[model samples]
Target: MASAKPKFPAIKPGGSLILAWQVKGKHVVVVGGGEVAAGRIVHCLNADAVVTVVCPTSGLNPEVAFRVSEGQVKHTDRNFEQSDLDDADMVLVAIDDPAASTAIWKLCKERRIPANIADVPPECDFYFGSVHRDGPLQIMVSTNGKGPRLAASIRKFIAKQLPSNAGNAINSIGNLRVKLRSIAPDPAESRKRMAWMTKVSDTFSWEEMCKLTDEDMDFLLRYYPENKAPSFSELRIAQGAPDPQGVDPFDGSFGFSVGA
Candidate 1:
């Protein structure tokens, strides 16, 4: 029998490998001056890249143009040049002319430089994601260049649902780990302690624990009946809770600061 036709494309274009780049002290070339280019330029600047705009027009953004005037960026109001890609670790081409943009993309590929072409998915190496940052915590949503609007809508939804205390909660939990290591320097002892702490975490929320002062913390550890985690049955009773069927009593998702 003849081989059945392949049911689908061997590889889909939508699969993305996400990563964060260290752009500090790196050269980033932006090759357009339109509003889109302006946004791209700002992103590069925020990442601490040494940015240069190579759009030969008044279309270059005011903020970037102003920065160029102040000697922050190199601006060549001219056509794309091979030299523009020199020393550029990342390139973004935002020009209106397809031929020019394509040429720039080809050159970037030849030099193995990372690149993005505004609104032209096929010609681009990567698509930007809608990102929300809280200190070191970040939530990024992407559409794999399929529907940026949908990705943005999802990001808005996520932003609304994210807890305001997320950063503080993470910090408190991290500090507890440091304390655990100091208290149990032996590897096996640390693991045993960590297992106990993990059980405690299942019962107590960071918010409740964080409310305790340093003195309270010391008292709880040093004087509070052997630093023992409460038995699950005891926890269930103390929580005014129902039967757990010998599993977690809660039917919903919980965080580090749960039950308390």
Candidate 2:
């Protein structure tokens, strides 16, 4: 009898994993000098990687070439060789020639070096994602290297929905998290406190949250003994009203009515 194929949940390529690679302070090698390469280089730089670009034509991009010339990056004016992969933490191939990029891709795979070949999925270990930065927070969107343009469009849409004060709000929440972690006695209690904190942060106004003083934080902690208190501040405004004085409604001074 034919058995039904075993069903397994399919995980997309860009979905979060139990373990993720850390590229901070690593060496990233780029094999191109065009605009695409420039974009990849920017991403690597943001990740704090020491970036190196290998290309033959200095005329491809003046800004990038100048940066390389100024020692901001390591540059080699030639095609890629196996030796280029030496000491490289990761490789990004964005050259105009697919054959050359593919060759490098194969070598990187063989040597177990993570590689991303621009516009080539089968040859890539990972792909660049569209990113939006709000102060220290970064939001990333990716279509698993399937549709970069679509990812970029989605990013723009999301950027509009984000609040103007989202960065400040995030900073406030982070500060709150540190305080909660320090006071919570057990790990389980800490997780519960963090959940309450997140709920409070999400519900409050940015202005009220930002204006919260030490006294307000104390009040919250005292009031909510079981849960971490979300910080808030009082809002005050002046209401327009006339003073208690005899004055004409239309004129500035007291006066008899015209009919009387």
RMSD of each: 8.5, 12.0
TM-score per model over all chains: 0.64, 0.69
Model 2 ranges off by over 4 Å: 1-21, 57-60, 144-146, 181-260
Candidate 2 per-residue C-alpha lDDT over 174-233 given as tens digits, one digit per residue, 9 for 90 to 100: 766666566665786866886777666665676566555454443444423444332232
Q: What tens digits encode model 1's per-residue C-alpha lDDT throughout 53-128?
A: 8976576677767777887777888877999888999999887888888888899999999999887888778888
Report every candidate's CA lDDT. 0.70, 0.70
